[model samples]
Target chain A: MHIVDGALSNPVLIGGGLLAASGVAYSLKKLEPEDLPRVGVLSAVFFVASLIHVPLGFSSVHLILNGLLGIILGWAAFPALAVALLLQAVFFGFGGLTVLGVNAVNIAVPALLVYFLCRWGLSAEKHLLAKRVADGLFLVFFLITIWAGFALYQLYQVEGGSWSVTVNSVSLILFSGVMAYGYFLYRRGILSVAGFWGFLGGSLSIFLTAVMVAISLALSGEEFGKAAEFVIVAHFPVMAVEGLLTAATIQLITKVKPELLHAVR
Target chain B: MTQVLGEVSRSWTLDKHQQTQEAFLQSLDPRVRLLVCVLFSCVVSALHDMMALTLALGIGLGLSLFARLPIWTTVRKVVVVDSFILVLVLTLPFTMPGEVIFSFWGWEASREGLFRAAEVGLKANAILFSLMALIGIMEPSVLGHALYRLKIPIKLVHLFLFTVRYIDVFYKEYKTMRMAMKARGFVPRTDLHTLRSIGYLVGMMLVRSLERSDRIMEAMKCRGFDGRFYILDTMKSGPRDRIFAVVSAVTLLGLLAVGYL
Candidate 1:
């Protein structure tokens, strides 16, 4: 999801812009001349992946592939994602050019972190259990980042407010419950098949939805209560569909190109 | 599925619009256009006053008209991207806390939220339209060259250039892979099968692209290509370009002064 222009305050915008600039600069330095083709191909893949729409009941959810891209590309995801976002803004009008920096940060930073956190889990073990665990950890990490960042910010802004308290409590319980269930599944190896991707995908979509809610509250200046309501009530099933789609993709990759998975690092 | 395919194809051809248009925006120096758009966006982003934001939006609309962009197409593009903003604009009145403007079903709509939403909406629309008129009408290669001349990092520009160059090719490859799957009696469904198929499609595309890039690198090296991109189209700011830049600068500065002071 793209943050529209003028939605964020100047400090956040400028801060995000600077951070994204640094990331791209670093990625540029790290980019070897020989690897330009790899970057280009991956960038194209990332761009097209966003265009793939998985059918939901009434509508469809486009593939974000943020976690997948991050794990594959590492720090390189920054520049690649930035260029894709720019084209989206210019051509399809998916995002605004003015706020491209903030949007890149929102997607790329989380992606980089996921790469660092989950790469080991994905690459270390060949069993389906490891995949499930990696995906679960990614979901857990995402949930915690959103809660700690946004819930705390809201709490500080309106000390002891009922709305802030309610959001924090709800997020903590819901997120913890998901993580616990995911861990339960991971431990039992119940989804130790092709469906592991689906489970992970579902978790990732839900995590993204939660993050979107938090962003709307924190950056978009939406009343937290309303934004949370819209996300939780309206987008619940889209997460499941996204999860299924992601699962299928991972399964396919594992079957055909096992080397690609390990080679990403 | 076709909608998605249509969008991909459409995005790839967006650069063609710059080639077709003969508007003043197209003729102006791209570097000037880039700088002005950035400056105007920053100004629009910093704007708080409603009148000032509306004024900025009017300028954006006016520019689109002058640039000879299709009005309905521009509106549709802006609306598609700013749909979330539209929701915020509509709901802010009811959700934002301030003096009650109205009440419906025990929900009080506030005047302050309405104003804030309008301000944000105006800014969003303003920037969207301005960019469509400015950046939307520029060729990607030219834009890349402009960024290079502006002293942006060489690597980033090259990546941008190559990415733009190959996006369409890879998309076509993706289409071919999907078609091959279809030819094999593959049908998309809400199951592991469909996802796996798509995954295979994506993986296949990636493998092909990696192979293709190697070939491309060889071709470039064989053609005496260096790391730098050289533009054949020379940029000389004629009196027309100079006049447009000055007018745009004055208008933007005037708006900032009026909005802030």
Candidate 2:
């Protein structure tokens, strides 16, 4: 979700701007001069990839592929994603000028987090570590789902019922189930270690991006609470699609061009 | 699918052909244009008064007219942006608690929420229109160079430039692969096969792009290229740029005064 201009408060805008600028600077520092071509080319690849709309059902969804970018580019995802976003804003008017920083942070932070959380699993030797990480994440999400279920039940009892709350809680529980099934598949050896990590990173990045977008929106004003919740719920399908796509992509990359995965780091 | 491809190709080439046309914004100094765009966005986003926001939107529309941008295309793009914010705007009236303006399905739509939504809509449109008029007309390479002159990090600028340079290339590559898949009778649908095939396509593209980058690196090295990139086109602010800057500064200040006081 690209947040349009003027929706965010001044404080949130400034904070996001500063954070994004520093991220770009830090990533730039980590970038060696020689690595420029590779990073830039991959950045272009990502930009084009985002333009590719995958048929979902009646409608289609464009690939964000931010998690795959993170896996391939590591720290470089910040600048890569920022550049892509700027191009989108300028060329397509999809996003605006002022909210660029906030949008960048919302999309790229999850990418960076994915990089940190899943890079280890890319190695065949780290299969055990990958399995453990997947299981741990599954347990964490399971616990969260249970806790949120209780809270939602309490909310429903108190407020009688609200459509937004019901939709939100149900989607979240469904989302957790999706994650658990993904992990279950990984644990059952249906997916390779790298594929599992790819699935995790892909879906997790989208999940986190949706959450961050929601937080940014809700933090701006109390009136945005409903819209913020709706944003997360709307992204559930995208998360599952991206997860499966990333898993397949990572599996292919690991088989054919494994060096590309570690090229940036 | 072909319509989507056509749209992508058209948008990519749209401004390039238009750049040859003598437009007011195309004639201005890129750095001034860029700075004014950023300033306008900042000021417009900060403005809360509906009157001032409306004025800002007028200025935006006026600039687009002066820039001689395609009228229907510009309006269509603005509409696209509005559609994106529609969710937030539509929910506002129902979500915000205030004096009820209307009741729909037992849900009260608030007057304050309606005003807030209108305000957001105005601010967003104003900034977006101005931004498109000012910066969207510039060559992306020129924008990169302008950022470099504006003292943005050189590495970031280089990345921007290189990314801009290669997006077209990779887009063509993507089209080629899509064509090959189409030749093989691969129709994209809502299925695991489609997802996996697209994923494999992306992976293949990445693999090829990386290999191409390696060759590109060697080509550059063979030409005695170093880490330092030289800027050949020096931007100078002329009398026209100076006059435009003054007018913009005054207009921005006037908008702020009208909005705040």
Retained true contacts (fraction), each candidate: 0.46, 0.76
Q: Give residue B51's lDDT in candidate 1 (0 to 100).
A: 79
Give the per-residue lDDT digits (tens) of candidate 1, residues B14-115.
Answer: 254564555657767788888888899999999898778889999998988988776676667776777767665676677678999888766688989778
Q: For candidate 2, write residues B45-119 as lDDT tens digits.
A: 889999999999999989988877777777788887899989989989988999998998777899999999999
* Model 1 residue B218 distance off true place after TM-score fit, in angstroms: 3.6
Model 2 bad stretches (over 4 Å): A142-181, A184-188, B1-21
**Residue A234 error for model 2, in Å?**
1.0
lDDT for residue B156 in candidate 1, whole number 0-100: 81
Top candidate, metric TM-score: 2
Tens-digit lDDT track of model 2 for A52-142? 9988667888999989998889999999999989988877787788888999999999998998888876774766766787778757755
List the pairs of residues colliding in candidate 2: none
Range of the 10 consecutive residues with the lowest summed lDDT in candidate 1 chain A: A228-237
Q: How does chain A of candidate 2 score by TM-score against the true chain A?
A: 0.90
Candidate 1 achieves a global lDDT of: 0.68
**TM-score for each model:** 0.81, 0.92
Model 1 CAPRI quality: acceptable
Compared with the real two-chain complex, what DockQ does model 2 have? 0.66
